[model samples]
Target: MSRSKFFLVVLICSFVWAFVPGYLFQSLTSISWVCWVFSKSVTAQQLGSGMKGLGLGAFTLDWTAVSSFLFSPLISPLFATVNVFVGYVLFIYVVMPTAYWGMNLYNAKTFPIFSSHLFASNGSPYKIADIVNQQFRLDTEAYDKLGRINLSIFFAISYGFNFATIAATITHVGFFYGKEIYHRFRASQQEEPDVHTKLMRKYEDIPAWWFYSVTALSMIVSLILCTVLKDQVQLPWWGFLFACAMAFTFTLPVSIISATTNQTPGLNVITEYVMGLIMPGYPIANVCFKVYGYISMSQAISFLADFKLGHYMKIPPKSMFIVQFVGTVVAGTVNLIVGWWLLGSVENICQDQLLPPNSPWTCPNDRVFFDASVIWGLVGPNRIFGSNGNYIALNWFFLFGAAGPVIVYILHRIFPTHKWILLINIPVLTGATALMPPATTVNFNSWLLYGIIFNFFVFRYRKKWWQRYNYILSAGLDAGAAFMGVLLYFTLTMENRTINWWGTGGEHCPLASCPTAKGVDLGPDSVCPVF
Candidate 1:
């Protein structure tokens, strides 16, 4: 097949896939829910609280599903078939028992609920306390009640839109690359290869199927567990599952890049660009809040895996690993501490008003998949400059931000400059910030700061630093944070008996002076004697 013709077909498919799912499905769902249901004060509160509840309930169940499914599917087809035939059997007999065991283990290792020391626990536990207190507060109880009513409706909207966006991004990228390769071959006067032929010849070395399958299965398990166990569990199971799913999903690119390119800076650049384009409307800080496990560890893993692969191909594993570990630890820790400080302060000070309404930290507002339509609806078509305007601000910023890279590319083309342009990413990012609405200026600035730090320290230091050391450092930091998160989870969620220091004058205690008869012999300590 001729390369040019192939590229043309690929381009066409990319264009269609990108627009169809994102616009038709995600946009539609977001508009309908955000505008009609979520925007209403009563409905919004109900929806918000419900989502929080659902997210918590599903946390554990999803983790079990994700962990088990990944290994199960990777085994033989017989195992996969058994998953279908004995699926219910496994759920009832195997999964349930495991979950029960896990719960018991958790209880034994954790503190009792309602304990004063537990209540006084700060950080994540305090955060959970705040959430619960806020939900049941006299002022917000109405919203809490309403949130329950509209919970399922909003979940469907938000999750559906999220899936739609993922679908669009993947399909668009696939088609775009496919066609680009096809066109290049056609331009060289080669015959157009069939899909199968192209797959075998060009992408056979890419491990594309492995990447796609892992990602798809991870998402499927997450959805199933979230839906089935959302209301059944006391623990925050959904959050756990979400974290695991994100970890695996984020690992896909790292694995691919590791196996293909030996820790190339170009891969990081490509990833950053793709992330910028696809994740624009959402707050970038979410990378820390929701998917920190993936974001921090995956990059380190990519470096390690790539180094290991290179080692197997005759590179020095021990030396490379050390370099990677040190670099990652130094940089990732700084990033985490800095990010926590900045975002935590912002969260405290700004509260709901931070970033525009739909920014990442603002829960109900940041839930873009389900709420986009409503936000856009409120903004309407004409009042694009209004503080609440959605599409206009996003569209303008995206257009300009996207163009910054292109402009850089053009300069490189004309001047044939050296690697100095790499330094321009910082300034270019600053320029992008300038394009955002005044309301979101802080958010953009935060992101710009992160990008600059990431590029300068992490990306650029790869060659100078040892790969293994970096991975170890990143892994250690993540491990520490995860441990703290678990501790906080137990301190906040577990039910415990509370002892009142002051005795009450009742049957359980003793009325007034009657309790003074301590010298009298009681028949049994368990049973108080009648005086």
Candidate 2:
């Protein structure tokens, strides 16, 4: 395929990834009442049933077990917090930055980050090229081995540090240069007024205190009503109302910021912290947390930010949306297939029981266990340092990881004459990649490839591309996925429901359902039994 055509196809798929499954899932599961109420001609009941079934199947295979493992007290608190927080932060700051840095560094050192690779015929395979060309081929045996590698202390420590450092770095950047960055972007933009004018306007624009008081009081009442009538509720009357309120309250500021700023260092850091803290806690609630993490109302807020930025920058919203959508779909599709295949391979290896007892692959749950153990396990004599102190070394490592660019900048200064020296640090491109245990090597590799493609082709080449677009795309996919996830959670737990109204009137509501409601049946019940 031609480059543009290929790009277009990929972009379309990404949009589908952003909109399709997530919207379908949300429409059917959480807010099916919209279709039922507005589009009365359609059979909302049947659609809801079908969606519920699909959600159940997906949840059963993917999220349920992982969620349970996450929340289970059997998993140490420290481990849970570290892994979850790290994963959340990395997805935002580290993954994108590392990918962009690696790709750009590679381009700067060797080629242009934006130029088409199809024109070059080096025949020499780069790390990213090898993975992409191989179609991410790792046999079941290799996958299992990789899974084992993923579970190692090295992988845990490296990834943990990478995430923590990225979080700290982003936070620090916001603290130091946030206002400066905002002003710089604002200065560059042709339409925006100066900082003082903007600040005065913001003060004038904000609603009166009484307005906020009334809104807060209304929200409290709504929360109470939702809590009281949760089980008795039908479709999403309450949910829709709540969502609208949330969108109006939160999405507006995000949108306004996007419309005004070229860069939002302050908001970015705040977002990273919020995402980091909340994302980990999500899985503690249920598997749907993962889905929601990807596609909740936060996603809508992100989308508005992107949309406003695109609008202000004179970029076509349609084009930006399409590009983001295509990238997400491509990445998600590859991730799902590869994830499932590798998971199967790991399962097989575990069944054969070839690895050591605590190996990550053989013990899939070891990620949680190791994280928890490392932190909470350092009790008694280790209490001198405090529970947080055990992670001190790891934290330093993360700080170093976040300072990756600065380190490269220093190298550039030292070797001002020797340009190639900057390339040596390119191996940090594989920082997260190297941290993956053998079992999950395939999955991590796939993710890395996606990151590289995005950074090199999309971010680097499309210099004028609004950064908010990336966040919006991420949020949209996450929101869509999350809505479906919540629906699936209700289906998996809720029982004895009536269908007269949107099939949501049920006796056993998710809020009231016991943690052990689904029989506490982890896996086959006979093997790897849950207590």
Candidate 3:
């Protein structure tokens, strides 16, 4: 068959395959067969559950698990995928399990082996509202009585690495590309622009004032919202300005890594941390500041990518600017409409506990977002990462990340010809498991498995086939799966259509979340296993 024919065939197959895991046999999303084999053994399930536990011999059949987000195996290179796999194996399999079972760090034995959920010292859920007052600020008296908020071992360590990811981005970029950037900045002697840049000289370029006008108008509007609508927004105009400054500072380095390696370290962690310190007890303000600082930089990077595409395609700069501006407005409006439609159409949309069995409305990513608001905004860093906090040592990950690139640079110096030494991208390595919490073990496992198959095996052995079909394959599968998801949601799930079966519900590993610590009570009626 011709390549186009094969693409059509794969596209059809993708649509069909999505039904098996997405609807018919939902258990395929969490095929923890090991848990099924040892049905009654809590310990066994804890070791085998892909969604809630160690994920030994666990994998997902769902394509969304593998390709939905930025970590899509189709796009992220094999070497980068391997780095993520290494991070997952060591952290999830080795480090976290050992801490939970052996050292019992930070009451690790009192919480699930892997979860984003916050907990108390006694293995019970942390009631977030207990520490918040009527006006939604931190109630000091309530917090003092409640004591320090605690996170699962996974959540705690992940925050540490998050801090590291930011630090690593700066040092890694400087070590690898600092000299090149410095040379470019110097005005005396200059390297010629690339052919793409020179080719673009035919058309009149966009005036500098075009960009400045948009920026100034945006700042003015944002300032009005922050100050005039203070009651609803809760953010100070100064806080908004500071958030803009932070985005401006980090965009160059973050965008550099993103452009080259398809890796974009987030501004959320650092943004929220600084804002939490600056203005405590205001969750709305923190969330607002974070949205400004993180989203602005990422969106800016996206626009730059669009501009680069236009340049390479020989489109005029003025036309590119106009298209992007109008396109952005249209895209954003469409997104808002779709978001509202989904929110309104679905009942108990994100409330997992209240939803019926086998419901797929669980908003896992939103759960992570809410937990962040509680940790850094309502509770503030004073209770979570300062002297009053239990895990203050996590701040050291900053130093560790900053120092890592220095070591790699030294190793490259020692063996200049060893090309493999440079492949050790420290920034990518450290930020490998960045998707955990909202992402499961099966998600990483499935993504890595495909990354190896295509990027490593196919790219190396069948270069022609890969070059022709790889991206086409990605596009086909993504389009098919997305179409099926919307169709299923509207036709079946929204109308309260139901299905009942053993395999249709969640990963059957309830005990995986139960703390193994002796005498730790889950409720008035239940206590944790002694072993």
- Highest-scoring model, lDDT: 3
lDDT of 1 by residue, 144-189 (tens): 3322111111122222222222332233223323466467657866
Model 3 over residues 449-498: C-alpha lDDT tens digits? 88878998899999998888888888888877888888888898778676
TM-score-sorted candidate list, best first? 3, 2, 1
Sorting all predicted structures by lDDT, with the top scorer first, yields 3, 2, 1
**Ten contiguous residues minimizing lDDT sum, candidate 1:** 504-513
Best by TM-score: 3
List where candidate 3 sits over 4 angstroms from the true fold: 1-4, 187-191, 201-204, 314-320, 337-347, 524-531
Candidate lDDT values, in order: 0.31, 0.34, 0.83
Per-model TM-score on C-alpha atoms:
0.27, 0.31, 0.94
Q: Could you give the C-alpha RMSD of every candidate to the true structure, in order shown?
A: 25.5, 21.7, 2.3
Better of 2 and 3 by TM-score: 3
Tens digits of lDDT, candidate 2, 240-268: 35344434443433333323322111121
The TM-score between candidate 1 and the true structure equals: 0.27
Looking at candidate 1, what is the lDDT of residue 218? 50
